[model samples]
Target: MSETARPAGRVDTNMAHPARRYNYWLGGKDNFAADRASGDQVAAVFPTVRRAARENRAFLQRAVGFLAREAGIRQFLDIGTGLPTVDNTHDVAQRIAPQSRIVYVDNDPLVMAHARALLTSSAEGASVYIERDLRDPGSILEAPELHATLDLRQPVGLTLLAILHFVRDFEDPYGVVARLVDAMPSGSYVVMSHGTYDGVPAETVTKLEEANAASGGLSRPRSRTEFTRFLDGLELVEPGVVPIGDWRPSPGTRPPEPADICMYGAVARIP
Candidate 1:
């Protein structure tokens, strides 16, 4: 496993981090009491939240596989990578193309402590982790570690799964996405999955919103139109933006109802 300069920061067990809360939802034990409290608060209102997390994760794995196997991509930039579990970006990509290189970016210090786990790359490929906020695209792009692992001159598969919703409008989510996309080459592609309330009932959406606010959670589900704006000029791949599970599901597999997942996923070519 290889890594760049490790950024120093304390893990605040008193407050919940999106990454740790997500870990808790995924049934991982690397979370603290605050994360559990926050996760349970949302789960109480939206009972299918755990399923949503799983569906989002499944979409990520599928997208990575498609990028490496079908799209012939050999480089990946996975932003907002939560605590690693299974089928990580490198795992899926390297399985198809062993020379695939991956650069994972996450702001959580706890994720950095666990970077070694994510950095286990196939001997023919490379993987590196960077502790940097997605809000600051410039910093992440300028980091020496990124250039060392990936060649910006080549196409890259940028995956932003289930993370942008936390980037509130005030944080300039559009700007963050645009800056990252602008840095990639024309043939590059972007895979994104975002939380939404489109198929959910108005009453349930209201309750979920209140629950998140009460728990001090940062989740901000966006509407389809709003989320579509993030891909303004990109060419969307077939099976365009749809419910998380609707995107290229494995043959004969049954997908959850859009209301059950309440998330949208898509992949678009940079051209």
Candidate 2:
């Protein structure tokens, strides 16, 4: 497959984007000074921010592997795909099923740039990147590459990992998810991880909120109950929504404490 063309958007290094800041948290060199500054500001308040990022990323990898290996899913639609990192959706899924097809969507042009260069597919699989906002699910679903690569009539694993919080309340994050889920077939699955203030003390939550505001203030952490609402009407997998590290933890790995992780993760079927 040919590399995707550079997406049509200006790379604003002066402003910190969630994708770049997340890259900084993951200790990647793709971020700018502003992203590192914003990441530092959040880390100053929430000391375990990097841990949360790592655990969230691990959850995504595990969930993708489960979808491909256990759930019998051969296609994936990963929205809010940040900077290409280790064990991305395609990497995990294709390892289990080389024929798996994946469509990655993100608003960050820098992410799309890296994806075009780094996210290659195996000879038996396909990986396509589309620069589209999560808020606009329609555009992503309607992208020509998506239709060309995936068959919506078949079961697809829709992974929305650590992205919904960036869609503010006014943006109708639930609506965005509903639109995407509604488009999938009955056997499709939705895998998600979201930031939360569930177990944190009131003071710590206040401090974290302040630190986020001090930065770009692009994210809105939702409560566990609120996050669970994204899976309403769907059949949740075993153990339901729990701290990101607690969801089907890999053997021999010590799961992080719920208090430190501060993120909820779950996988559910569309039926």
- Give the candidate number with the greatest lDDT: 2
Tens digit per residue, CA lDDT, model 1, 120-146: 999999999888889989988998889
What are the Cα lDDT values of the candidates?
A: 0.91, 0.92
Report the error of model 2 at residue 87, Å. Answer: 0.5
Q: How far is candidate 1 from the true structure (C-alpha RMSD, Å)?
A: 2.1
Residue pairs that clash (backbone atoms under 3 angstroms), model 1: none
The runs of at least 3 residues in candidate 2 whose Cα sits more than 4 Å from the true structure, single-residue gaps closed, are: 1-8
Model 2, span 13-71: residue lDDT tens? 89899999999999999999989988998888789999999999999998888889899
RMSD per model, one decimal: 2.1, 2.2
